[model samples]
Target: MKWLLACIAPVLLAAWILFLSAHGPASWVLLPGILIGIACAAGLSFLRSFSPALRALSLTLYLLPLGLLSTYRASAFSVSKDFELGALPLASAPSEMSIAQLPTGVTYRSAAFGYRGGSLFEPRVFSMTAILIKHPKGDLLIDAGFGRDIAQHLATLPLPFQLLTRYTLNKTAREQLQSSGYDLTRLRAIILTHSHWDHISGAADFPEVPVWIPPAERSFVQGEDVTTATARSIKSLHIEEYRFDARPYLGFAESHDVYGDGAVVIVPAPGHTPGSVIVFVTLADHKRYAFIGDLAWQLEGVTEQEERPLTQRIADFEPRLVREHLAHMAAISARYPELTLVVAHDPRSFASIPKWP
Candidate 1:
């Protein structure tokens, strides 16, 4: 009876946590349940009737799932082979064209949260950054980042997300632009990589500026999906929907060249969301960047081809589509070593871009 009790407690504990991770309610609600399991397991040590060997086995069983969850590798998907990408398109970027990064805030998390094989002890700072693309025609903001009303924005999220997420806000993208004495008139649109709250929150601050998105994303924002709750809550957004022409830029089947000069091209890579995109920006110096939004949370998603852990199913709308796009991007990175692939949440990916003064 003693051996059976010792063995069963840790096994039950691991199974309970795994079940909650997948199907539990809010993260806060999960805490009490998990703590109770821990307390029960800890209490079992007082059973001196169990042999020392039995106690050792119980401890090992309790920790095995945690170790696997943190470091288990997922099978990698293959890159698209049917599509052939020819020579890079010539970009007629204006001499005055430039780009900058506006870091609004960061969320502290373990590397394990971003991708599989990442260490739980290793801390990763997820950047809530927006990009500014200055053009002779009109300037564009890649994403909104955090906003002045971030507290309200956060409150709109699911309670589980709110409980698990810890963030620190700096200046919003709107505040940064205004403080820099930027000409608001030159701003054409806030081109969203996706309509997720973290990317669209600051757009509320610029009610007058139009928010450009692909048609699919417009539907997502207008739909009843819980993911776009924050975006739907912001009634002031001026939405301008656009479509993609059947022009293959890189391996992508369809592309929308925003500037018509091969300088700023938008390509659909909708796995993270129904309308997620990869924005390709070419500068006057011919430096190129591909701002991939949440396809992978970190550089390793492209470089090493690591996908998010299975437990983080909530992070992706369609995991299969994400893997397809990720494999596609990974192939592009390999073919064009000079082009920089910027993952939205990876701060290190923005090191080359200058920060807004």
Candidate 2:
């Protein structure tokens, strides 16, 4: 009876929290968590020395410390961040062509809590963004975002990840572009910030288009998966080797001008993924935008240098590198608040900004 009580309490608590933190935060989160917790408790109870108090205390220590530490760590991270407007250095320009920013489709809505640890426990709606760069030479799409069949991608995901992404797909990138009256055929190529499913799922919509991938991130997907199928079908993937140069600027050593013109440039911002990069778009109006690809899920993560919590980090390609990169990004943003840093999946940040010229 004592062991049974111990098992029940932890199962209920774990399930409740897991369910709430998921993207959809559905009641479905309860079942998996409860089952896992029960299995764990059963294994521990095999010990003859196990008692109710001991079991409860063990679970308490494990669960309580993780949450408390996450909150405390986020607070400490926020405290470490600060920047000045005058300290940002501007480098020499390479071209004078004007570019336009156009975003397609609705941002795929998600939650701010467990999906992104930087937002604390708040359950605010977030987005998976898809942006278009209209250049004189050709237009480029950054982060393909969601598609009509986003559920298929989510279903193929492993374990905790599959359970985490439970949000609805508002529309596909292609649907957004066509509805917005943009010429989809004119799209020169698709630029993937990284090969994450949400960002690449919609690539299937534009099969004939050329795709550009970062040198560092080309191997993000290791095994045979849906991402591979999408990538393999691309018309061509050029390293754009000549454009990729090892020059120090914008707190990064490597940068590339998309069109051999200074209108659009890709900069190394590794950490979120080893190959993750950011796009620096300087419009004809002189306004500059940095499209950060999952570097920080929320802008607050940049301001506070708070990463996506410990548990979330476990699933990341490289969490330590991610934290270091987050710190660097926050420092850059701090020094130049005027340099607009657009997060890929943050709807609030994307809302105030206009899409396409």
Candidate 3:
């Protein structure tokens, strides 16, 4: 046991140093990784004391270079910079004002599935979706894609989830929003569907914009589930929480009117996470667009009725009132053919929408 500790102590120390150097002392993003690594080292060392085979297997597992190959293969795809920045193929352009979908930034498919039981072989893959919305008032970003640093972080560590290597922030969503004629200073507000790392990475990009977060998600972001740096970052933002109100949009429950004029509506759709939400945008001509974040990985979840199994879904994440709110969205989408539902992280759906400036 002592020998094993001596061998792993250096590796752990090096990881800690690297983490601090990259993000500073405030960076606690890798806390989970550090905890898991230490636990594994301790458990394996104890086991090695009893069995030589266990010791050999532990050493071999740590030495394996498969994680690097996985990261490389995952990051192979490139995001398209030149997406058609206009309306959908079927929708007619509004004659009053130009309503276009702009790709503020692009995201790539990461290995789906978040950490579970500390096993890399687990077949779970969480979807990574990002969107940029350009309104006459100002440019609004739905969710920020995973930053480059996160991909690099995942590559070296044996995290259970896939790293989004292919997706690069070709231009920060902030830049795209600015080019689209939206001033960050005047930027009315930024709404996060949830506080997951992928969705909130770009929050730093819009520090000035008042962020609207779900009340349920407040605890998660403020709690130990997130890194101290991340929590602090979230705390620094101007955050407002909305009670689930299923009154607006005709049967959709639990939403906050971002602009008050009904231009953008933030709806609570919890299942994937406690504070999962959907952003609803109403164009000049009263056309509606729903930015549903991670309700389903692909559009198929909403389109083909293929959602995660009931057992796998988060039940206590959102209160019963919030769950009913999600049902309202489903029902409204079914009834309103004109209302466009945007699924965050789906490449096909993102491709179908017009890119932002």
Model 2: lDDT equals 0.61
Given candidate 2, what's the lDDT at residue 194? Answer: 75
Residue-pair clashes per candidate: 1, 4, 19
Candidate 1 structure lDDT: 0.82
**What is the Cα-based TM-score of model 1?**
0.84
What's the C-alpha lDDT at position 302 in model 1?
Answer: 75
Q: Compute each candidate's TM-score over C-alphas.
A: 0.84, 0.76, 0.57
Angstrom error of the Cα, residue 12, model 1: value is 10
lDDT of 2 by residue, 1-357 (tens): 555555455555554454455453444555775675675566456435686667556566447424633442434543343323243334333344443334433322223442334333445555666777766576788878776656665566666656655565766778777777988778888787777767877776776676677656666554454434444433333333224688555666677876664667787766666677778776655677778877776676676566665454544566666666677767677666667877776676675466544
lDDT (0 to 1) per candidate? 0.82, 0.61, 0.51
**Deviation from native of the Cα of residue 13 in model 2, angstroms:** 1.7
Tens digits of per-residue lDDT, candidate 3, 232-281, equal 44444667676666554454435576545666677666656667777777
Q: Between candidates 1 and 2, which one is better according to TM-score?
A: 1
Candidate 3, residue 228: Cα displacement in angstroms equals 10
